[model samples]
Target chain A: MSLFIVNILDGLVTGLLLFMLCSGLTLIFSMMGVLNFAHASFYMLGAYFGYQISTYVGFWPGLILAPIIVGFIGAAVERYGLRRVHKFGHVPELIFTFGLALLIEEVVQYFWGKSQMAFEAPGVLKFAAFSIAGNAFPAYKVFMIFIAMGVFLVLLYILTKTRIGMIIQAALSYPETVQNLGHNVPMIFMGVFGVGTAMAAIAGVIAGPVLGTFPGMAVLLGSIVFVTIVIGGLGSLWGALVASLLIGWLQTFAAAYNLRMADLLVAIGLTEPVDVAQSMLSDLWTLTLPQVGPILPYLLMIIVLVIRPNGLLGKRET
Target chain B: MNRFTKSLLGAAFAGAAMVGSFSIAHAEGTIKIAFIDPLSGPFASTGNQGLSHYKFAAEELVNSKGGVLDGQKFEIVAFDNKISAKESLIQLKVAIDQGIRFIAQGNSSGVANAITDAVKKHNRRNPDQQVIFLNYSAVDPALTNDKCNFWHFRFDANADIKMDALTDVMAANEDIKKVYLIGQDYSFGKAVAAAAVKFLKAKRPDVEIVGNELHPIGKVKDFTPYARKIIASGADAMITGNWGSDMVGLGKAVIEAGFDNPIYTYYAASDGITKTFGEAGEGKLKLVMEGQLNPPVSDRAAAYTAKFEKQYPDYDIGQPRIANVIEMLAKAINKAGTATDMAKVAYALEGMEHDSIWGTKVVMRASDHQAIQDVHILAHTAKDVTFDFDNSGYGLRAESTVKMASADSATTCKMKRP
Candidate 1:
C-alpha cells in the first residue's frame, strides 16, 4: 500500500511536470491555429539558458530570468519570423517551427558540445523530503510538484478570472471580431505566443536539473508533449492537464510493476511453454512491464485517437 | 596561337602531371590506416578522442621510432562513420576505393560486427584486395566469440573478460550482499548483465540479485525513478554497462538520490563524465578499465602520458590500448618484414606477446584474435591519488587487478582461417 502511495506521488510529480509543457503548447495551438513544433525546443533553450545563468547568479536568479529571456526570444520569433510566414498558411508556419527546432538543437550542440551538462539542483533541495516504504522521496521532486501545481493554479486564474484571459479566449474563437473592438489582436497573439513559450521555459528551468541538459533533451520530450496536448484535446487546456496526468500515472504504474506476458499466457491454459528460440511469439513471451513502460503512453494515445478523435476535453476533431 | 607558346604550355602541363603522379606515388608508399568512427553526433567526443590518440600514437610512437618495416611511415586517415553501421560500411567502401588497407574502428560493437562481416565478405570475394580491422575499444564478447573473423583483431579485452574481472572483486568484497544490475537495452548491455549474473552466481552464490533492469538506450530523459527503484530494492551495489549520456544521467540521478552504494561501471570515468561527476562520484563510483592513470604504472607510461597531455590538452588516452595497438601492429609488420602483405602481418600478430605500457604482459591469443592482459578495478578517489583524469581533480586509484586467462577459455570461437 505504501509502495502504491509512493507510485501515485511519483506519478503526480511526473504528470504535473508534463502538464506544464502541454498547457503552454495547447494555449499556443489554440490561439494561433498552428501547432508549434518548436515548443519543446523552447523548453530546451530554457534549460540551457537556466544552466548558464545558474552558473553565474545561482538557481533562484536563473529561475526568474531564464523564462523572461525565452519570452523575449519567442516574441521576437513571432513578430519577425512567424508573422512574415503567416501569409503562406499553417503548413509553412509549422514547417518554420520544425526548422527552428532543428536549428536550435544545432546551435546548442555548437555551443555546449554533445554531452550531458552538470546542471544540478540547489543544495538545499538536494536531500530527500521524506521517506515512504524505505524509499526516500527527493525534495527536488516534491519541489517540482509544488511549482507545477502553483503554475497550474495561477494560469487557471488568469485565463478564467482576468480581462486579458477573456480577450485571449475571445480572440481564439473570433480574431476579427476581437480586432474590430480595437483590442490590438496582433499584439495579443504575440503576447500569447510569448507567454506560452515562457511557460515552457519555466518548466525547462526546473526540469533541466533532473532531466539533464543535453542537445537531445528537446527530442526526448517533444513528441510526448505533443501526444499529451493531442490526447487532452488540441485546444483544451483542461484536456492537456487530464492527458498529461494520465500518461504520467500510467507510465509510472507500468514501470513500478514487473508483470510478464509469459505468466499471463500460462494462466490462460497454456500448460507448456513454447520454445523461445523456435517460436515466433518468443518476443511476446519474454515481454515485461518495465520493458514496455515507455510505450504505454502511445498505446493510450492510439486508443483515444481511435475511439474519440477529438480527445477527452477537445471540442473539434484534431 | 604561336607554335612555340603552344609547345611551352604542353611542356608545363606534362611537368605538372608528372609531379602529381610522383606525389600520389609517394603518399601511397606510406602505410595508411583508416580510422572509421563517429566524428559527429552524440558520440563524436569519444570518437574524436580516439582519433586524436591514434594520430598521436602513429606520430609519437611509430613514426618517431624511425618508422616500421624499413622506414615505411604510418599515417592515420580519418572517416566519420556517424556511429551508424550503414554509414560505417559506406565509409569502409570509400576507404577501400582509396587504396587504404588497414581499418581501425572502436566505438560500437554493432558497427564493429557489421564491418567485420563486410570485410570478411569483401576478402572472400576479392582476395587480392583485403583490409585488416584493428578494433581498439568495442568490447562486445561476440566479436571475439561467435562472430570472430581472421580479418579482425581486438586490442581491448572483451566484455566477458572485463566482467570476469569485475565480479572477482565483487565476490571478494564481503560488504556487498544484495546487488542490482542495470544497463542500456542493447547487445553490449545485455552481455554485461548476463555475464554479471553468471559470474556472480558462480563466484558468490550467496549474493542476491535484487533487481535487474534495462532501459532504452539514449532515450531515457530521467533516471531518478530507476534510481529510486534501485534504492527501494535495498541493493548494496549496482553494476551498469551504460556509457555516454546514459552513464552521466544515471550517475547524477544516483548521486542526487543519496544512494551511497557503490556503482561499478565499464565507462564512468572518461569523456566529460569524470568532470561532470566531480565530487559526487568520489569514493563511491568505480570503473573497470585496461589502464590506470593514478599510479602511472611505469616511468615510460608517465612520460608518454605527460607528452600526450602537453600536445593535446583536451583529450586523455581513455583507451590506453591505442598505444598497444600501434606498437604491436608495428612489431608485427616489422617481424613480417613487409607493410603491404597484410596476410603475413596477420600471421605474425597471431600468438604474439609483449610487455605493455600498463606494466603488464599482453598476449594476442591466436585462437580468437582477442588480447589477453591483466584488467584493473579502479576506485574513484579525490585525494591520495597519483594522477587525476579529465581535469576533474578526481582520479581512479587501482584497487584490484585480475590476471586474465587465455582467449580459448572465455571464447567459443571456432575461427576459420583463410
Candidate 2:
C-alpha cells in the first residue's frame, strides 16, 4: 500500500515536469505549425540565467525574473529571427531551429564553460517533507509539485476564460477566418511563441538543480520534449497533459516494481531457465519503465501517428 | 655583375635559403603524439582535464629542460572522439594518416575498446613507427585481462585490481558483514562490483551479500530511494562503482538521508562530492584509491600543489592519480632521452620509481605495467576541521586505517623486452 502511494507521487512529480515543457511546445506548434527544436535550448538558457541571477538575487526572484527575460528573448527571436526563416517553408524553419539549438549550446559554452555549475534548492525547501514507511520524501519535490499545479491552473484560466483564449481557439480552427475578422495572426503567433518559451524557461528553473546546469542539457531534453509533444497530439494542450501524466505514471510504476520476465515465465509454468542471457529477452526482463522513459513518448508518438493521425483529443478534420 | 651588387644578391639568396630550410624542417619535424578523447558532451570535463595535464607535462616538465630525443621538441596533435567508439576508430585512422606513431588516452572505456584494435594493427604494420597507448583513466579490468596487448600501457590499475584491494581492506573489518552493492549498469561497473563480491566471498565466507542494485548511467536524478533500499537491506557497508556526477549526486542523496554506514567506493570521491555532502560527509565515506588528498605530503609536493592551485584555481590538484600519471610520464621521457622511441620510453617507464605530487615514490611494475604504489585511503574531513600534522604531533587520523598492497605479488604478466 505504501509502495503504491510512493509510485503515484513519483509519477505525479515526473508527469508535472513533462507537462511543463510539453504544454508550451504544443501551444506554440498549434499557433505557428513549426516545431521549435530549440525549445529545450530556451529551457537550458533559463537554467543558466537562473543560476547567474540566483547567485546575486536568490532563487525565488531568479525563478520569477528568469522566465520573463526568456519570454522576451523568445518574442524578439520570433519577431526578427524565426519570422524571416518561416517564409522559406516548414523544412527550412525546422533547420533554422536546429541551427539555433547548436548556436545556443555554443553560446552557453562560451559563457559557462564545460563544467556543471552547482544550483542548490532554497534553504526552506532543503528539508524532507515527511517519511512514508521509513522513506523520506523531499520537501523540494512537494514544492515543485505545487509550483507546477499553480502554473497549470493559471494557464488553463487564461486560455479558457480570456478574450485572447477565444482568439487562440478560433485561430486553431480557422486561421484565415480569424485573420479575416481583423485579427493580426502573425502578432498572435509571436505572442504564443513568447508564452511557450516562458513556460519552458520556468521548467528549466525548477529542473536545473536536478537535471544539472550544463551545455549538453538542451540536447538531452530536446528530443524528449519533441516526443512529449508528438505523443500529446501535435497541437492539443489537453492531450499533452494527459500524455505527460500517463508517461510519468508508467515510468514511476515500472521503476518502483521489481518485476522480471523470469518471474512472469515462472508464473505461466515455463519454469525452465531458457538461456535468458542469450537473447534480447534479458534486456526486456531488466527493462524498468524509467530505463525506457526517454523512449516511451517516442514509441507512443509513432503509434499515434499511425493509428489516430490527429492525436488523442486533437480536433478532427473540419 | 659588379662586385658590390653581386655580394648583396648572394646575402639575400642565402637568407631566403635559410628561411626555406627552417619552414621545411618545422613541417617535416614534429614527432607527433596523438591524443584521442571525448572533447564534447557531458564527459568532456574529463577529457579537458586529461588534455590540460598532458599539456602541462609535455611543456613545463618534458620539453622545458632541453626537449627529448637528442633535443628534438615534442608535439601533441589532439583529436576529439566525442566518446563514440565508431568515431574514435575513424579518428584513429585520421591520426594514422597524419603520421602519428605515439598514441595516448582511453578517456572512456568504450572509446578505448574501439581504438585498441587500431592501435594493435598500426603497431604491427609499422614496427619502426610503433604506437604506444598510455591509459590515463579508463579502469576497465577486461582491457588488462582478456584484451591485454603489448602496445597498451595502463597508467592506472585495472578495475579488478582496485576492487581486490578494496575487498582486502573490507576483510579486516569483520564488523562489515552485510554488504549492499550499487553501481552503474555497464561493463566497468559490473567488473568492479563483481570483483568486490568475488574477492569478499573468497576471503571471508561469513560476509553475506545482502543486496545488489544496478542503476542506469546518466538517467538517475534522485538516489534517495536507492539509499532507502540499502538501509532496508540491513547492510553494514554499501559498495558502489559510480563516479563523476553519478557519484557526487548519489553520494549527496545518501548523505542527506543520513546513511551512517561506511560507504566503500571503488573510485576517489571528488571535491564536488564533498561540496554536495557539505558537513555530513566527514568521516562517513571511505574511498580506496591510489593516492591521498590532504597532508603527510612532502614539502616539494606541497609547493607544487600551491603553484598548481595558483595557476588553475578552478580545478583541484587533490586528484593524486592525475598528478602521479603526469609525473611518471615526464620522468619516463626524461630518462629515455627520447619521446618518439617507444622501446626506450617503455623500458624507462617499466619498474621506474619516481616521486609524485602526492609525496610518495611509486614504482611502475615491469611485469604488468601497473603502478606499484600505496593506495592512500583518505577520509573526508570538514574544510573547517584542521588536523595538526606537525605542531601537535597528533598526526592524521586515517578514519579507519591505510592498507598498502605490495606491487610484487599482484601481477605476473610475462613480457618480452624489445
Candidate 3:
C-alpha cells in the first residue's frame, strides 16, 4: 500500500513536469499554425541560462531571470526569424525551426562543451521533504510538483478568464477576422510563442539540477513532450494534462514493478522452450516491464492515434 | 594559341603538381594514427580531451625524442565518430582511405567491438592494408577474453580485473552488509553487474545483494524513483558502472535523496563530475582507476600533470594510460627499426614491459594483448588532499592499491598471429 502511494506521488511529479512543457507547446500550436520544432531547444537554453545565472547570483535569481531572458530570446526568434519564414508555408516554417534546434544545440556545445554541468540544487532544498516506507522523497521534487501545478493554474486562468485569452482563442480560429476587428493578430501570436517558451524555460530552470544540465537534455525530453500533447489532443490544454498524467502513471507503475513476460506466458499454459536462443520468441520471453517502460508512452500514443484519431481531447482531424 | 603564353602555363602547372606530390610523399614518411572518437556530440569533451592528450604525447614524448624509428615522426589525425558504432566504421574507412594505418579509439566499448571486428576482417581481406588498433580506455573484458584480436591492443585493465580489485576492497569492509547494484542496460553494464555478483559471492558470501537494477542508458530523465528503490532496499553500499551524464544524474539523485552510504563507481571522477559532486560526495563517493592523482604517485607523474595542465589548461589527463600507449608504441616502432613494418611492431608490442609515469611497471600480455598495471581504489575527500581534479576543489585520496600480477589471469583469447 505504501509502495502504491509512493508510486502515485512519483507519477504526479513526473506528470506535472511534462505538463509544464506540453502546456506551452499546445498553446503555441493552437495560436500559430506552425508547430515550433525548436520548442524543446528553448527548454535547453533555459537550463543553460539558468545554470550560468546561478553561477553569478544564487539559484533564486537564476529562477527569476533565466525564464525572462529565454522569453525575450523566444520573442525575438518568433518576431525576426520565424516571421520572415512564415510566408513560405508550414513546411518551410518547420524546416526553419528544425534548423534552429540544431543551431541552438551547437551554440550550447560551443559555449558549455559537451558534458554535464555542476548545476546543483540550493542548500535549503537539498534534503528530503519526507520519507515513505523508508524511501526518502526529495524536497526539490515536491517543489517541482508545486511549481508545475501553480503554472497550470495561472495558465488556466489567463487562457479562459482574461480578455487577452479570449482574443488569442479567437485569433487561433480566425486570424483574418480577428485582425479585421482591430486586434494585433501577429503580435498576439508572438506573445503566445514567447510565453509558451518561457513556460518551457521555467521547466528547464527547475529541472536542470534534477534532470542534469547538458546539451542532450533537450533531445531527451523533446519528443516525449510532443507525445504528451499529442496523446492529450494537440491543441487542447486539458487533454495534454490528462495524457501527461496518464503517461507519468503508466511509466512509473511499469518501472516500479518487475514483471517478466515468461511468467505471463507460463501462466497462460505455454510450454517453455528448451533452447531459448534458437527460439523465435526469445526476446519476448526475456522482456521485462521495466525494460519497456520508456516506450510505453509511444505505444499508448500509437493506440490512441489509431483508435481515437483525434486524441483524448484533441478536436482537430490529426 | 601564342607559343610564349602556352609555354608559361605549362611550366606553372608542372610546378604545382610537383609541390602536391612532394607534400604527399612527405606525409607518407610520418606514422599517422587516426584517433577516431566522438568530437562533436555529448561525449565530445571526453573525446576532445583524449585527442589533446594524444597530440601532446605524440609531439612531446615521441617526436621530441628525435622522432620514432630514426625521424619518422608520429601524427595523430582526429576523426569524429559521434560515439556511434556505425559512424565509427564509416570514419574507419575514411581514415584508411586517407592512408592512416594505425587507429586509436577508447570511448565506447560498442564502438571498440565494431572497430576490432572491422579491423580483423579488413586485415584478412586486404592484407596489404593492415591496421593496428590501440585501445586506451574501453574496459569491456570480452575484448581481451572472447573477442581478442591480434591487431587490437588494450592499454587499460579490463572490467573483470577492475571488479576483482573492487571486490577485494568491498570484502574487507565489514560495515557493508547489504549492497545494491545499478548500471546502464548495455553490454558494459551487464558485465559490471555479472562481475559484481560473481566476485561478491566468492569474496563475501554473507553479504546480501538487496537490489540489482539496470536503467535505460541515457534515456532516464529522472533518477529519484530509482534512488528511492535503492534506499528502500536498505543497502549500505551501492555499486555502479554508469559514466558521463548518466553517472552525474544517478549521483545527484542519490545525494539528493539523502542516501548517505558510500557509492562505488568506475567513473565517478574526471570530466566535470568531480566538480559537480564537490562537497556533496565528499567521502561518500569512491572511484576505481589506474593511477593516483591527488597524492601524486611520483615526482615525474606530478610534473607531467602540471606541465600538461599548463599547456592545455581546459583539459585534464583523465586517462593516464594515454601516455603509456604512446610511449609503448614508440618503443615498439623503434625496436622494429621501422615505423612502416606493422607486423614487426606488433610482435615487439606483444609481451612488452615498461615503467609507466604512474610509478608502476606495465606489461602488455602476449596472450590477450591486455595491459597489466596496478589499479587504485580512491575515495572522494575535500580536506587534506594533495591535488584536485578538473579544478573541482575536491580530490580522490588513495584508499587501496591492487598489484598488477595479482590482477592478471589466463584469458580465453585464441589470437591468430601473423
Tell me each candidate's TM-score.
Answer: 0.93, 0.84, 0.90
Candidate 3 ranges beyond 4 A from true positions: A174-177, A271-279, A315-317, B1-32, B65-73, B84-101, B117-131, B405-408
Q: What tens-digit string does per-residue lDDT give for candidate 2 at A57-153?
A: 8999999999999999999999999999988899999999889999999878766666566677788888778766655677888988998899899
lDDT of 1 by residue, B1-418 (tens): 3222444565668778877865654365688899999999889999999999999989988899899867889989899999999999999999999989899999999899999999999988887788899999888888988899898999998888888888988999999999999999987888899999999999999999998888888777667668777877889999999988889888887776668888999998767688778787887899998876768888988888888888877677788899999989999999999877778889898889988987878899998999999899988888876566676677788888887643446567898887
Q: Which 10 consecutive residues of model 3 chain B have the lowest summed lDDT?
A: B1-10
Top candidate, metric TM-score: 1
Q: In candidate 3, what are the lDDT values of residues A1-318, reduced to their tens digit?
A: 776788889889889988998999999998776788899999999998898888878999999999999999999999999999988888999999999999999878766777778888888997779988777788888899999999999999988999988998899899999999999988998899999999999999998888888889999998999888889998999999999999888888887777888899999999879897789999898788888889999999999999888899999876
> What digit string (tens of lDDT, one per residue) describes model 1 on residues A242-298?
999999888878877778878888899875355775677777887888788888889
User: All candidates: CA RMSD in angstroms?
Assistant: 7.5, 8.9, 7.5
The residue ranges of model 2 lying beyond 4 angstroms of the native Cα positions read: A180-182, A274-309, B1-34, B58-81, B84-102, B113-125, B172-177, B204-207, B219-236, B252-286, B326-341, B379-381, B384-414
The whole-model lDDT of each prediction reads 0.87, 0.71, 0.88
Q: Rank the candidates by DockQ, best first.
A: 3, 1, 2
**Global local distance difference test of model 2:** 0.71
Off by over 4 Å in 1: A272-277, B1-29, B125-129, B385-387, B405-410
Predicted structure 3, TM vs. truth: 0.90
Q: Can you tell me the DockQ of model 2?
A: 0.25
